[model samples]
Target: MALRPNPTLRQRRLGSELRRMREQAGLGGSELARRLGIGPAQMTQMEQARIGVSPERLRMVASACGCSNEPLIDALARMTSERGKGWWEEYRGVLTVDFLEVAELEAHAERITFCTTAYIPGLLQTPAYASAVFARLFPPLPPREIETRTEFRIRRQELIRSGGTPLHTFIHEAALRMQFGGPSVLLDQLRALLDDSERPGISVRIVPFAVDTFPGAGENLTFANGPVAELDTVEVDVSQGALFLESPTDLANHRAIFSRLDATALAEKESRDFIRSIMKEVESSNA
Candidate 1:
């Protein structure tokens, strides 16, 4: 009924799908609005996610648009009502919006493939490790700000362990030994990685120095597969903010990047052994 100032990423995605369906069906804005008994302005608002669309209305739209994929239609229906805000909503004004969107994507993603070269995967970082990583910001953040970010990151990890989404994370070996928060912190972080690697629906791989060469900085990203292939999203974090890529070309390119990284990475078992070896080295150094 009321307009939203900022729709969540999921809501925008639902809107995007409706637009895609209309386009794929070769329906025009005015014609679709005519068929659905809505004004072009309202159609624009609904398709832009500025206004909410009911599940009934969403189904009506899909039916009018000729999108017949049942599973996708069902997924789209679920997005129509994003009842109850997610945990990330708590930080709406407290943190940057882009980061919150990234978290929301992670939460609803059916499958996620993350490729990192410098930093440990956010979903896999320990509080201390995340704190240390967050501490290195260029302009620097206040202690309270850092604490907020650390908490947000820790919360993001819950989605992976929640038993539905599958995670395939590729980390550069250098990240395992970066000594963030000091030797003890990094040691604990690596041990945490070892523990997480063994979890169901979670796959952690390492791109070791032995790989020699692989994708460069441009490839560092998180590709979150929505309920369906067409809805997939790619997120790239930068110093200033995060970039959310949803165009078909962007998704395809990032998917290719992940495939290469996946191939370059050591097998899951070997990756754990690799992490264990690094942890032992850190442990021995402290002893």
Candidate 2:
């Protein structure tokens, strides 16, 4: 098959897993390629995610590399076996790869946990709220681009809404009060938050300003739990854009940081009360 000029994050992730397994087994790409009866370049291409690997080839490579973790292998195989294009394909030309990656990751993730400080988690945002945030783009997106992106955000929410994957989000109190679009928009957003919180498969927790400390406060993070710990991925939102981290060390660090955040944040019940009080605060101010 011809190589994809641009590989999605999931594809790149599969390649990373293969590379890790090969390294763990202390086998070089050339040696492995020889064992598998393929060209060295073909092995490199698969590992670089420039080319897709068939499910049969995936198992062959895993077995050849002596990758013993059955769960990881199965998960990787499943990723490869996923046929047909996903909904994100429709936005291929309109949005950058990173934006599409977020949707793809969320779509397949077993579970999603987001710690958002500056803004509401995208999945939980209302159309008006999301549109307002997009409209404020500094460089200013073309009108059509803004509309497209906002629509994409709304559609992405369907992953969780469909009850296919569970989502737990930790949000700071500041975000609940930001009033991104103005009082009317903010009011509706807070109500939407309350509504989403009540939905099955969705959990929302708040970290009050009164809390003594907030760890990993500056960096926005979402841990998209895969089928197993080995396949787990962490996303860090930076100024340049989203950064995907899957190395053992990066995963461990992010896991610990989120554990702490989850521990310090309000309990789900208290979080509801906190959100309600904040709603009242906003109401009084607007009055």
Candidate 3:
């Protein structure tokens, strides 16, 4: 049989700590498990992150392994607690794991930045606009499924409201010009953008077509800032799929690109005026 790939982020973190504990004690998996009074397989599972390790179990294991690190145990406990069912759990059966992970990450992110080159980013999309986009991508989906996805999208947008830290979007001028649902729907969406742009926490910068080249112009990117002290993560959307990056070097690269994009984008007041210009054109077409 082919060997499976390495574990995920949360898994790898947990596994690394467990492996360190075993190494410190100079004990292999079976030896450590024997000392901990658990089956070797169980201990192996914990180290591989194939199974969830409770705070109590982790503490006991650490103790048996001759490791008494309170801070490490506490961190593992927090991870265990956070592994409980999240708001995205309901969509697990239907949505891909990749999509689910993104949703969960977004929920926990203290701040998010998105650069869109095509359609409006999900957090900024109107219901009508979202519906149109989803329909095109999921042509055979039933109306109910479409509604469910739309509702989820709307719920996701709640993260950007005044009640919470808002999502910052750097929208390209081309996205504002594209009428997804129709001219009327696009008009309403732009009007919503105008109103939302006034929000203090929410920053919307428009990258004009006339502006010189920038990194975001070629691709889309999402940055999910971790807890205050933790390093941030950057996800670059590619044609194949979304790539989650956590390396310090990659994160720094994306941060720099975002700064450059911000510099190239229109100033706040200018962006609002540009949005107004498009809104006016929408009105003219309607009239």
Top candidate when judged by lDDT against the true structure: 2
1-287: candidate 2 lDDT, tens digit per residue: 88899888888999999999999999999999999999999999999999999989999998998888888889999989877878999989879888899898888789999998988999999999998888887898888888888999999998889999999999998888888889889989989999999999999999989989998888779999999998888998987878989999999999999999988999988999998998898899889
Descending-lDDT candidate ranking? 2, 1, 3
Between 2 and 3, whose TM-score is larger?
A: 2
TM-score of 3: 0.76
Candidate 2: clashing pairs of residues: none
lDDT of 3 by residue, 8-63 (tens): 45555566668777887898999888887889988777887777777788787778
Q: Return the TM-score for each candidate structure.
A: 0.91, 0.96, 0.76
| Candidate 1 clash pair list | none
lDDT of 1 by residue, 125-199 (tens): 999999999898868899999999999888888888786789999998877879878999888888888899999
Q: Against the true structure, whose TM-score is highest?
A: 2
Cα distance off (Å), candidate 2, residue 229: 1.3
Per-candidate clashes come to 0, 0, 0
TM-score of 2: 0.96
Candidate 1 regions off by >4 Å? Answer: 280-287
The deviation in Å at residue 78 for candidate 3 is 3.4
Model 3, CA-based lDDT: 0.78
